[model samples]
Target: MLPSIGMALVLLFSMSGCGEEDRRGVLFKGVVAPPGIVMVAGGREHTLALMADGTVWGRGSNFYGELGDGTTLNSLTLVQTVGLGDVATIAAGGLFSMAVKKDGTVWAWGYNGFGALGDGTTTDRWSPVQLQGLSDVTTVSISGYHTLALTHAGTIWAWGYNARGQLGDGTIEDRLTPVPVAGLTNVVAVSASTSGQYSLALKSDGSVWAWGSNSSGELGDGTWLERSTPAPVQGLTDIVSIAAARRHGMALKRDGTLWAWGANYYGQLGNGTRTSTRAPVKVQEPSGVISLMGGEDHSVALKLDGTVWTWGVNDQGQLGAGRDDIDSVIPLKVLRLTEVSAISAAWTHAMAMKQDGTVWAWGLNNRGQLGDGTTTNRNIPAEFLGL
Candidate 1:
């Protein structure tokens, strides 16, 4: 049985925010934690922290109480995502969020205007509510208006907006609950972006599948037609990790090569041109990238040497460089950032955590989403305090 949201908060403190050791920047290098902790960009206005103790902490925007802190309040301090025993993973959308527990149970919270919560109702949940009939959800991808989950058995389940067939259920009907995506199995990773109204999954065999909206060729099927079913992304064989942007998609191969497709109005595709491609094209970066993340109109990459690189729209200086007007067509190094553990990008904003346990943010700060206790937009990256 689920405990009351209040008691869950009390028990949550010890489990969720208990780990406060100074990370010498080698958490992944040592055997202390699992290898290559997954990082999702544009997932939430605030990031989700799913600790090993089965608890979740969220720090960022909470307009809809998506933080799962049992109140419709914004928190600068890390607050419990849920008062659950232990959570395995977490996925956050624009307004709603979901988590998979260690026991294969699923929980959801926040906005349900279109039934994104998957609780068999359209009512918004301020606190985490157990999802019905979903077990062993290994990973979840939350888009602007939809949600997708990959089960332990390799089956893909989808819910929320179907206006653009982003749900991939062979129909344009929005789902209030989980529905299986047809003709897909043995999937290793799943991701959804904000704009494209589509989803991508990389199978265990190094092949790529794309479905949903394709108006701007976000599906990378060489056609502008929308697909409600899974289709192969052309020229993208042997891909290992994939990322979706608001209007474009990018993938990284096992060979440390990066590829991009779809919308390129602001040079996000990094192909040294502003033209959009309907098929996968290699991103023309000279560096070997280990991690890649995309935001509303910008992208950030982590090179093999622990340095951060950024490109695309820098209207808000999301590139983390000191100058705002200087836009680079190619990847440029973000200054004052080093030994970074991970980085994430949001709308007109970028954030990173260092190996020394400090967090920094740059770009749009309209709602104080940067968490630096200031509403001023930063052209260069600034330190975020009070964590």
Candidate 2:
């Protein structure tokens, strides 16, 4: 959400956490917001923003209280998430949210029908609740009904939905608490699909591993079969990052090249084709990429040059090219956007964070996930009000 004009005008001043006298020798009291937002993430319908002050704000779908505002009311404006602070990073799932604080503790809220909350129960939480027995967490990732946490020690822990073996514990049983992913160590990153049916992990050794559903070959192990444990993604190495969609997977290699596999019925593979591959296929785009994100059937990439590109499904103008529902089988530069520092793609919408710290959004906004204080779908990128 963008900072409102009233909020911007009311910003008296911000002080550091140390409480030392500022060089300006000025002070203010009873203020909440910090300087600006540092990061933004999009869920199935909700949106989450992390401010420089370490607090989180959420908007959109709150039927299951994914907003974590201690209420089930949907919001068109941003609301401070209840009881979350000192947060280092945050992740949003299909109907849930997770945050990792500076103290290394993890917290979760929202839908828990499959025990995705990791609170030892299948009850929904309307507010942030400390995830039991998880600490030293370096990062967290969430999907439809599960969550994954990477520890400073390089081990991977998973919980929640395990159907299709997404939990990676060599079982299909749902877990209410965290469980160590069997046979995985030195892991640097992890990702889960929006369907909670597949998962991927990147190791420090530059290798990629995958498990869970392969109904569309999302596991990318040169097979169309599901695995209850982690398996090396065929022919992919020297990888730096990975992303998982509902039925497809993406990997960014150290060379800045992108690779993809699995479902491509909508040309999500970005290979100028709509064929599904059981093994990784090189994405048809120039290198120099810094990051990539996958939607349920589309993909977005942020180049090192600070430009954003997207491909695949555009039924909702998700490509941000001002085109009306025209799918692209190749990467298309997002029209009129530059200096993007980060990007996120949801089930049908997309978001971008400019280097200047302002947020922009396009595509599906039926729930005001765009945070522009409206529920209109955008075919072109527009400044989202209230950072």
* Clashes by residue pair, model 2: 1-386, 2-385, 2-386, 2-387, 3-386, 3-387
Model 1 spans with C-alpha error above 4 angstroms: 1-44, 325-327
Candidate 1 residue lDDT tens string, 1-387:
211211112111222443322221122123221222233223435556555455666655666667787765555445565466567777777766788777888888877766778777888888899988898888787865678888888889998877778888899888999899889999988887765279988899888888988877888989998889889899887888888877788888878888888888888888787888899888877467887877876788887777888878888778887888666667778888989887777656787877776667888765455767666778777876544
Error of 1 at 89 (Å): 2.0
In model 2, where do residues sit more than 4 Å from their true spots?
A: 1-33
Error of 1 at 243 (Å): 0.4
TM-score of each: 0.85, 0.91
Tens-digit lDDT track for model 2 on 311-387? 89999888899997799999999987889889988877889988888889888887788888888888788887777
Please give the TM-score that candidate 1 achieves against the real structure. 0.85
> Which candidate number would show the highest TM-score if scored against the true structure?
2
